[model samples]
Target chain A: MEKQVAIVGYAQTGYESDVDASREILVLEAAVGALRSAGISREVIDTVVTANNDYMDGRTISNMRLVEPSGAWLKDESKVEMDGAYAVLYAMMRILSGDHDVAMVIGVSQASVFPTYVPGVMTLDPTFDRERGLLNEVSAAALQARAYMDACGVTEEQIAGISVKNLRNAALNPLALRRMPVLTVDDVMSSRMLYSPIRELNAFPPSDGACSVILASSKKAAEITDCPVWIRGVGFSHDSYLTERPLDKLGSLKQAAERAYAAAGISDAKDKIDVAEVHENFAHEELMAYEALGFCGEGKGSALLESGATKINGELPVNPSGGALAANVACAAGLARIAEAALQVRGEAGSHQVKGVKTALAHGQTGLCAQENIVFILGGE
Target chain B: MESDGLQNVDMVRIPAVPVFNWSVGNFMERFFDGLKGGKFMGVKCPDCGRVYLPPRMICERCFAKNDEWVELPPEGTVESFTLAQVKVGEDGELADLEAPVLIGMVKHEGADTCLVARIEGPDPEEASVGMRVTAVLDKSAESILDILSHYVPR
Candidate 1:
């Protein structure tokens, strides 16, 4: 068996539309705050992994200016050009390899700094997809949404319900960017339609945010913090080309979730895991994720929404921090999910905290239609 | 401003536009060469017998080097479509078009993947799933955009 790893500390800045602060300040604040929370200084960190996108940053080597701020000064440092959850995965591998006892992962992005959808467009197949110039993140998501809705007989009202539930839940999360104290499905349905079934409120709001996670081996985790969220399992997978993969289902996410469940010895996710933090950029995807994660049978996600099983006070609460629909900062979104899931396991999630979350699942994805996926399972000591 | 926690903030505009000439690579080079000749091209994996539309050098599942290049018909069935209402401008604000364009994903016969392109030569409401469509090749086509301007119901 590989060496055990645990999350000892994490910190996140307020999710806002425009932070008006430099990227350096955003990264430093999260990293330093996480170190303080863990009761450890820079001297204790053996390695650092950072997640940032060069296209989004408008600068190459997005981590160039972040080495010092990320507490990787003179220590082994690397980067994940995708989502922040991948950075944490890399840090876990480094510690599990026994080469590093403690690792720090940081993910920071200011979505307001650049044209939000342009970066998403740049990731398309430049040879064909970009030359056509019709699809971006939202449009591609709409295409996927149309396919999923048509395949499963899911109505636009179901999609609106997800946005309403998540946005209303955001009111309880002080750090959420787009909080709605009172939101209704009717309001979400009446919002301007961006692409056929996808309404204005169904899409993720652009925001500036950053988050950090400190991982330590079991031996060091015990000494650093009394409340350690044990990293029980990890899994990641990438689907084929956008044009090639099936749009109706999250095939890659299912593969990733399966691997994670097998690793964590979770035979039944619906019964075993008490809470779930899914990085769903669009409202309809939260419903689709329930099916992909094996919480319900295929094409039954819409029925799951009506069952109210995923509510904050329901049988299994999902996205107690409101998930990415509340505030999606691109590279930072997945790490925020991890941070939220960790809090749930630690019994420190404040107002949105579930009653008793023993084991929790955190999910993240990247690329069009969530082509790349990663899943993590966290358990409390 | 202090109440919102944003005080004395200044903005700077740094203009950066990078020009890159990406290589079309070996397989794409062959595919475009066929396009230049007014022919639809796809490479067939000898092991799996699956034809890739934007022909890949190697088959993802079979792991076999695709050595057979096959000429495909220009007609396909519509897998999915959307009448996009809003478009994101360079400024990231939603922009409006005089009329929404019909976009369709057409899967060519003998091909595994759908080729996403604009649906032209038909009314937007007339478009439906599983409709047979043919690609109208441009005789003087220089790129993928020019080769097949749009797809029409066959």
Candidate 2:
């Protein structure tokens, strides 16, 4: 890398079932709020990258309508129809190329307006899976959950524990929508069953929100803020389609985290990383991610959870902001994870703040059964 | 702006129905032809020997054309399954089902990959992993839905 990149500023719209505001307004608020947080003006932004999906927006080239609100008007702007974490990756590359000094990356989604689960079906293999119509995000996750359970002797009760943990964590985050500070594992198990293993409480709540982050060269980041969270390392990987790939394990997430840990010089993640914010669409995914992210060994995620190691005040906390289980803003969830990690690093994550956080990991994923994954390692020093 | 809330907001629904004519290509065309003759057809990768059901043109792992066509047996083991209590409509809206449907990932006798299909015989609670099941083909087959009815306990 020619130049180190850092996150200077970040902001997120309040996560809700319906934010009352239009998509453009949400984008504008997040974008402007991020600039304000950085103490920089819109004119200082050299490039803008957005994460949005045309199908989800129910419109084609949705970013065109967002140009003005995103402060990307007449500037070098583009969009990636993936998680906002990927957009941040693009913005980092742009700054690293020396072609841009500062970049604004925004990820926005209005899951309320559209049929949320329909888009997951649209991402399937059009020829066979679409016609069969047997799989969607939740059902597919149910299959993976079942496979993981059978392979490792993980019980549904163990998976339900994750919901109890994260939703309880959401209570501290005022911006979070699904705050269940006293949620219990039995409450999750008793929640309406969608698929056999995936009950209603086990899945992410569809949410409407936007997240924006300002990335700059190290020199520019220093000028923007005193507490710039450095992007120590980043890695992303995509696996085969859902059916062809092994369902029991998150192979791509493991590969992505390995690459990131290598780049960040993290030989022991469970010891070195202080906090983690992950995008787990389902409660089981967080457990799967625990193994994939090197927080635990294979099939040992449940044991780690039972050990209370991932609790808010534990040795290594995960998803202290409640995670996607509380408020999944579609494309923005990953970026919001990054933002939450940055907040932790800056000692600004109120209520849910962990004491003495120096290093953090943020993860984002797309596709059914987490077919694609991105990992970012952040540090305050 | 603070005055705006969920109350009295104007909402308009736009009906979207787009049509697409997909070409299933030569490999599927052959597979369908084989299905018409009461045979389960799959393509084996020349390099990796991974057999893909609903036969594809290329193998992802080996990066080579899947030129070998293999005949798969109707019987397979259930790798995993779900008792679906909801059904997604054409517009992608989810609605509760009167009775749960047992859907399984069935890996055929000779194929490496699994095909997701509805399993008919077992009660949702009775269905377990590694249970042997056989394909119940739709005799007067027209489409994939008609040609392959559902799987049943062998």
Candidate 3:
């Protein structure tokens, strides 16, 4: 919070069910692409932070094999086993601590390599939930969806509308894996039903992708790029376990957003923030996040969706990049949100770009029902 | 870098299973004992007085140790439920069920937190929030799943 940090460059691999590339290749492509985007070489980066999970990678110390590809062979390197946005937070700390001027952060996951839902099951309370084997990611989200609908009058149709919007927006993002430009809510409703109210279209498609972002201190940012997107504020919070916590709302996201807003001197998010890129693992979560981020009053996420404020061309467009629901790459999904927000701020998001001139909000989440949440406020000077 | 004809060569399935043993602790041990005796038990926190099902050693909210055990009525209200039409296989693939199964989060009368389990005795279409259900213990139990067979509509 004391030092100014900015995103100098970013890059992502094309998301797909099978990227036809090994984990190392994905990491190498993203890292090299990000360096090229920043017009800098690996020598300029003082530290490298990566995001990955051992369980998901099917190997211990999953980042061990990714060092050379990440351009961190000899440089100071570390890893955060969370979303890529969390790794960015760590890289920002390295620069803010005066120990590093520039840092490279990468997040990657190859969902095609292993079972996507198994790792989710491994995160459950081992003695009860895991042993019972009754609850998994889709079922948990389905339970949350039903609870939210019961509490907030959110219909299955409204939840399906979210998928229709994001999958349609994904049509514009060349890197997105799922693109249904003309997808209808009825189509989503008719998709293969996994659990009650959670059709296949309402859930994230597992994909293989990687994303890398270059961060620099205020002094080094201008040297890296003239159009660096400043990190105005950031906050992260983790809630209680999934079973113990209330499912109707995102309590941790609310706390994280409040802290980030206060740090950025943003009291009115709806008016000040021009664009938002949110990580919604499920359709209903976007609605829940709207309330948590104070974009709307509690239990009014469906109403906000109906008001047309969160569409790609609306007043405060959310997830113009298609979000996780479009092409979720697990660890990279959160980082992709940051990349999308930066592009939006720079007016470089291509067809999905909102007419944004100043500020943007990007969110990342981990855990079932979004128990862990991070919010970032970005701005361009 | 284009391998247009190498789709099959790209992936190899490695089937590996790693086993682990976790200690359920004193509270859960006793709760399982109660289940074996056809009783539902929970731990009551001394400070917050919040009772936790699938009993735990400490209350998360009060940050205090739970020394007292409370016996709860087998009946509870279904706070929320999902009619699962598909099951995630061991390989994490979704397979359709021959018939739908009901999973409910039931808040017992004396407990603060809800217990998640399968609900029986009601069709998927008939299952709704606020439905009352009672636990049905198995005649012979080996695992938690066996002891708490399912919750049937009351």
Q: Top model by DockQ, which number?
A: 2
DockQ of each: 0.51, 0.65, 0.65
By lDDT rank, best first, the candidates go 2, 3, 1
Q: What is the per-residue lDDT of model 2 for residues A286-319, given as tens digits with 9 covering 90 to 100? A: 9999999989999999999999999999999999
Residue-level lDDT of model 3, residues B13-132, one tens digit each, is: 656787889988777788888888888899899998888887888777887888998999999988889999998887787888898889998889888788889999897889988898
For model 1 chain A, the run of ten residues with the poorest summed lDDT: A1-10
Which digits, one per residue and each the tens of the lDDT, describe model 3 over residues A192-242? 999898999999999999999999999999787779899999999998776
Every model: iRMSD:
2.4, 1.8, 1.5
Scored by lDDT, the top model is: 2
- Candidate 1 residue lDDT tens string, A130-228: 767788888888878878887888888988889888888899999998899799988998988777777889999988989999999999998998889
Tell how far residue A356 is off in model 2, in angstroms.
1.2
In order, how many clashes per candidate?
Answer: 0, 0, 0
For candidate 2, what is the DockQ? 0.65
DockQ leaderboard ranking: 2, 3, 1
lDDT of each: 0.87, 0.91, 0.90
